[model samples]
Target: MTLRNQVLIWIAFFIVLMLALWIFRGILLPFVVGATLAYLLNPLVNQLQKWRFSRGWATAVVLLSVVAIILGLFFMLVPLAGQQVGGLIQRLPGYASDLQELARRWAPELNAWLGPEQAARLEATISDLLGRIVGFAGGITGEILASGWGVITTIGIVVFTPVVAFYILLDWEGMVRGVNNLLPVQYKDEIRGILAEIDSSMAGVIRGQGSVILILAVFYATALSLAGLNFGLAIGLIGGLFSFVPYVGFAIGFLLSMGVAIVQFWPNWWMVAVIFAIYMVGQFLEGNILYPKLVGSSININPVWLMFALLAFSLLFGFVGLLLAVPLAAIGGVLVRYGVRKYKASALYLGENGDKGGDQTAV
Candidate 1:
């Protein structure tokens, strides 16, 4: 095929693939999750292979060990998480009452500053918020129900994901080789270079981000739990997990910790400041220590763009979309860099008149 036709054919193939994915997205959850796992475990599998293990043995060892670890954590923490969630649920009513009482205590000052109408409105808003907090206690369960995932879905993830992952892992090398074999010989080197760049980028992001989040989670959870916040561990875990998307995780964790601290340590009140300080310390450690040491990337992406990718993917593909978004965004970034390099060399950009726009970025 001519080069233009080949390009068109590739574009058409991807379009069809995307359309198929969109159409059957509901059923793709397990496969997506499985593929993500395969990608993550591929490094370990490759390392084991280097140690002279067959691909099968490497995959089996990695998958079995990983599953065991996951199961262990689930069994170990589920009870604790359930206990914490239960306690929080039970105390939510009292927390709501305390908030109302606190609001009433400030009513005099609020009224003086804002006038009766606005003060009353403020009180109503407070009540509404507390009501939602009460609703949130309920919403936690409600949201689960609203998600439409049930026992079967859980089983699907637990069962089929490993099976799919195993096949992918088993054939991972063949898959890569197969794709390379299909590439046009003329562009194979260029494409292989791009794939190498992508693999390097992915490794840095995945392994580094995973370690960073785990470290932050441990730090935040331990600190908050020791500080005696009622739901600190849960809050910290959430914060740490969300940290993958920049400051989002920390902000969320901080807000929850603050709310819980206010509810649990009210009247005394200094505990709230203590909780805030814990988050500040966590943020400091993350910014100054963890990210610098772990995620020292040569090509730094804009946080704004990262946030945009997260939101855009979440909007388009829900949770699974969110899972795919970051890597896709990273890959997109790499592609954009390549496109820019090409554009810089092209007459359209350099101009037929050759305006000499200086050197192009080689990101």
Candidate 2:
């Protein structure tokens, strides 16, 4: 194919793929989740294969072991998190009352500092804010569920994800070979090189970052729980999970931990200080130790570019887009660099003499 024709064909293919994803987005969640699982678990299957297991048997064993681990974690953690959530909801009113009393106790100082009129305005504002917080806290779960409950049901995901993962894992090698066979003959080697780069980038960012998130979650959850903060487990897990979004996770975990500590142990002050110290230590460990060791060198995408890609994809394709954003961003980054390299080497970039002459003679 001519260069222009090849470009057109690839563009058309990309457009068609995007159109299909948009059209079938609602039902795509399970498949996307399954594919992601398969990708993550592929290494384990490869390890088993090295031990002389057939592909089918390896896949089955890995999936079963994963299922068992998930079930155990689900049963053990879900109930405790749920209890914490319920207790937090129940205590909102009491927390509000206590906060109000605390504010009132400082009323004299506030009046002396700000004058009666400003202090009165501040008190009224605080009351209104507290009321809004309580109301929002009470309904946030229901609001989230009502908005997202139908996107992918619990039953559908649980039933379909494993089946999709299994078949994909079993046929993984053949599928790779099939795709490789379809590459254009002229650019096959170059395309393969790009694919290799994409694979490396994906493995670095996704797998390495995954390890970072898991470690952070465990650390936060364990530390908070050991510190005896109310709803520590939930706070730690949520913070850890949210760490996928960068600094957002640390902010969320710290704020939630501190908020709970203040409410549960206000007069004592020591416990609140302990919670603050835990978060500080966690942040230090993540920033200085974990991220650098696992993810620093591997990340080629700029943070600003990453955030933009995530926001753009999420807006375009909702949840499925969010799931795909990282991999797609990595692919796009590699392709862009390849394009720039090609461009820089072309005659157009060097006044038509670059390709024919050595670098010393180029414009």
In TM-score terms, which candidate is top? 2
Candidates in order have lDDT scores of 0.80, 0.83
Identify the runs in model 2 with alpha carbons over 4 angstroms from their true place.
Answer: 86-152, 355-363
Candidate achieving the largest lDDT: 2
Alpha-carbon error at 234 in model 2, in Å?
A: 0.9
lDDT for predicted candidate 2 compared with the true structure: 0.83
lDDT of 1 by residue, 72-165 (tens): 9999987887687677668777877877888899899999999999999999997886687578558655655555468888898999999989
- Across 1-363, the per-residue lDDT of candidate 2 in tens digits comes to 666797798799899998998898778878988988898999999999999999999999999999899989989988988788778768767877877788789899999999999999998986787687668666656654653556456777889999999999999999999999998788899999988888888887678888888998899999999999888887788789778776878876776677678778978899999999999998898889998888876558877788888889877887678778877887888888988998787677655555545556643
TM-scores for every predicted model: 0.84, 0.84
Lowest lDDT 10-residue stretch of candidate 2:
143-152
